[model samples]
Target: MDVDIEDILAELNTDSTAVDQSGNPFSDINNNNNASTLYNESSSYPETNLKTNATSTSIPSPQQDYNNLIILWRNERCAPELLPYPHNLMTRMLSRIQEQMERLEIISMDFLGQQHSTTTTDTTGNNPVNNNNMLPLLCMEAELERIKFVIRSFIRCRLSKIDKFSLYLRQINEENESISPLQDFLSKDEMIYYESHSEILLKLFNDTILKHLPPNMQAINDNTGTVPMIDEPDWNKFVFIKVIGPQNKIFNTDPILIKGDNGKWYYEVIIPELQERVELIIDSIYVMRYKVIKDLLMEGKVTLI
Candidate 1:
């Protein structure tokens, strides 16, 4: 197509040096002469090329989209505020990445195939321009790789949270007890780890406490609190006892039971008027001496405070 000098001059607001009285930008040049002579004559005249303009107009850049994705992924990864439910967000993000990858694949295949076909048609395998076109393809490949890496990092970051807060996650999933905002997002391994770790710690604590007790003193069942007295026992002799109560039960004393924001219940006993809070509903946590809270711990009906 012939270059429209009039349209070009009008678009450029008719620069005084470029446009003459006849309205033609290059009035001095003959039609037979090359246009490069006019461009070389004046630095004020902006050079325009048909092929360069066409290529630039045809291909839309995806740089902005890539930038937006990077920012979103970074924020999602590093933000301290935890979403109440992250599974849904993960599902959405993964789906978006899959769709984007599929689209990118299609675009890359079509573009690369066209370039390859064009290059192959020329028997001379040494086309410099064809080789230069590979730069854009290389840049696209690099961008795709970057996006993929960030996405993988983002997923790993989320899984790291699941690993770090495994106990809280298990508590939420199993007992509907959300100890943290990220509690509901748990994996099977995390749940198993929490249960096993908790059981081990409780067993160790129980055994350590039991080892300090006298031989005559033993763990008495809730139904049988009366232990057989040892021979020649002094009046000061006493046994160490431990017990736990079921959930949602009232204690003998008017213990103030309060549930925390994390869904764990605490008790404040009025007898000794405890200044500190005591956790409730733990099966192995109610440790007491038989001499003090013996009768209360034996009765399964009353919850420890």
Candidate 2:
């Protein structure tokens, strides 16, 4: 996984007249005037399909996607409740992943083909390893693995949230058939997973514990009384957020109080005019209750670090 991407890419992008790692000036790969680079990142991309900016139709660079993935992974983990699935971002990223995979397969095949065609050896009496050719493949594979890891972690975080609040989501879904968090926040596959998990959990409870209880107490989601049985995400949970908005933008967040390690509560923000809300400055980090800044998070003004 230790890869130097610049060196490998630079070597592959050299002129046809230049000498290669094996000291062969005219290798089959370099013979053509317009040899295809291993990674034609800009040219290989499909049309831009981003939801972040609907009117902007230019493809974002790989670094932008990488940073967005990191932000999304953190936000999904730190937020108490599940967030909406990013359909457009995911679609573009997945398409690029598939294309990169195909490109790698082709390059790997070419490596084998070119090696077979090379019928020469140096004074060392051993076949050249072609380190220059293989380096890009190794680095690219490592980077691709990293991207897949982040994506898998993001999906797993969402699944955990769904599992933790399965009954709550189901109750809300049943109460309102038109609009619910189940329909708005969850993806189609995740909704199906929630349903399957809820059914299995209910069956397990009925077969083991619930069957022994009285009829009145047998219901799993008994929110009628003061104390509710079903669990829901706590909006009071504190999260670390950083303002990522433009210089001109400012957030007037709801007043939030935090309990310190000594069990003493204090206001993180000083009092201001209108409902005691405080101004959130740009490039500043704050620890506030999730409910207090949920709107800002939803509006893309701040990111959970």
Candidate 3:
């Protein structure tokens, strides 16, 4: 069957640059151990660096930024764990957003100039302002606002996580008081915020009530008792995800050879472990534990809803 090239290109809604040589975002993991592969391959992207102090000034295409920001926003919103900071993606997204804003400004200025100079009347001699000229500028402004909203929400989502689990995140990195602390799941700016926020809260607590406690009992992260003082994220939280990459054979595939009552061969196997034992087809939705799918989410094999 002959297919139109334009139709195929039109179907590629996301940025094609995201797909690597194998045409899979994570280079087409073909092993049963897919989760680990997701983690290892994520570092390949210039954007998803694990180093909290790392900086990225490279900008990707606008489409790539838009799609990636949406993915980051949605996953950050739903995931129980704080996903790795997408350094390059955020850098590029903000750059492109600023560029679009400048463009809108230029378009607005031009629209005003045209309105003052090119005033026109219809056959009825009515001299109303031309909304047709404002259409393109209005559309661009709307798009810019939408992108800005997504960026703000994405950052705010991360901030909320940082605020909620500030102690937990600090514990992840700052537990090592001897070494230079680096948040494994936070960006450099976010790390600053975390430190300031945590310090202020601790100081306020101590000034208000903790100062009266005994020195030994004043420890904030007192894990010595039945309940720990430090708050932690719910790693076992359930989330909805849509598969965006290939699945491992263990999922929705048979390993055993069997015979049916009709004497026909059937490959049947049971996996009582996986919460959602289904093949990862593109766009297939499933509900599963956040920790179980966290690696896949980082690898871009799936996105949270």
Candidate 4:
């Protein structure tokens, strides 16, 4: 077959003009170019790939949660006057008490001076008839009345303040129950006032209620191997045990053991013979090491006979 090269070139040119002049195919070509550019850009810089890996953490234990709860309670519950009450009632009560105490002290001092003066005057046989009996009794009675008044006033003031504080606390508790979880009624100023009031209340509570409690109730001094005991004469006494040699091992041989209701063991040893009780003050580090050993044994971290 005889090929016509000129004819074939002419046909190709005609097809190209037809494709471009129609506008549809030409626009399709431009759209494909734009689509290609967009695809390339999107693939080159992927949005999902830019994200960091998410990390999962374990939740805290129940004991840790409980401790957090207690801390929050201490922070929030200590100040009752800030939310609702006779405003600055605690401050007023404290000031009144102090003033009354001062007055009582002054009255006591004056009475004491008067008595001393009278006794001295009588010793010198210079007792005036008026000073001997009537004046002293009258003065003493007046001092007594003043003291009684102060005492009664102090008691009444304290009672009133306490009653008001209690009522406010109850209101707060009720408000807490009724309010929405998302709602916060306390303003910035109120929060600041509450914080200061809380600190004052904490100090007062510690000085008054906490101080009067038995020492064992206030703090757990595990450093001093003092195991609380019941049905024993010296229940509060700390027990000590003597280690003879510089050895790391604790043994059962002649080891003084103070056992509690919880089956916890403490060493009991008498020091300075004259001292009535046996008490040992263990270093915190040693106590911690001992605790680790104990925990290891309990948890099967170490095998023992």
Clashes within 3 Å, all models in order? 0, 0, 0, 2
- For 1-305, candidate 1 gives per-residue lDDT tens digits of 22233443432232122211111111111121232322211213233431232221121112212332343354335333222222322333345456546644765576567567777897775677755645544554565476578767765665555444444444444554344322343334444555676567547856888567775544421223464322211212233322333222333333544556886555433224344444444233544332234333323223223
Go through the candidates in order and give each one's C-alpha lDDT. Answer: 0.39, 0.62, 0.57, 0.33
Better of 1 and 2 by lDDT: 2
Question: What TM-score does candidate 4 reach?
Answer: 0.19
Residue range with the least summed lDDT across 10 consecutive positions in model 1: 20-29
For model 1, give the RMSD to the true fold.
28.2
> For model 3, how many clashes?
0
Model 1 lDDT, residue 259, Cα? 59
CA error at residue 185 for candidate 3, angstroms: 3.2
146-257 per-residue lDDT for model 3 (tens digits): 7788878878888888888877766767567555345434667888998899899999999998899988888887777999877888977889988655323223332333
> Candidate 2, which segments miss by more than 4 Å at Cα?
1-42, 45-63, 117-129, 246-276
State every prediction's TM-score relative to the real structure: 0.33, 0.70, 0.68, 0.19
Which pairs of residues have clashing backbones in candidate 3?
Answer: none
Q: Is candidate 2 or candidate 4 better by TM-score?
A: 2
For model 1 the TM-score comes to 0.33
Error of 3 at 23 (Å): 8.6
lDDT at 68 for candidate 4? 25
Global lDDT for candidate 1?
0.39
Cα displacement (angstroms), candidate 2, residue 207, comes to 1.3
lDDT of 2 by residue, 188-258 (tens): 78879988988998899999999999889898888887899889889888899986652122123323334
Rank by TM-score, descending?
2, 3, 1, 4
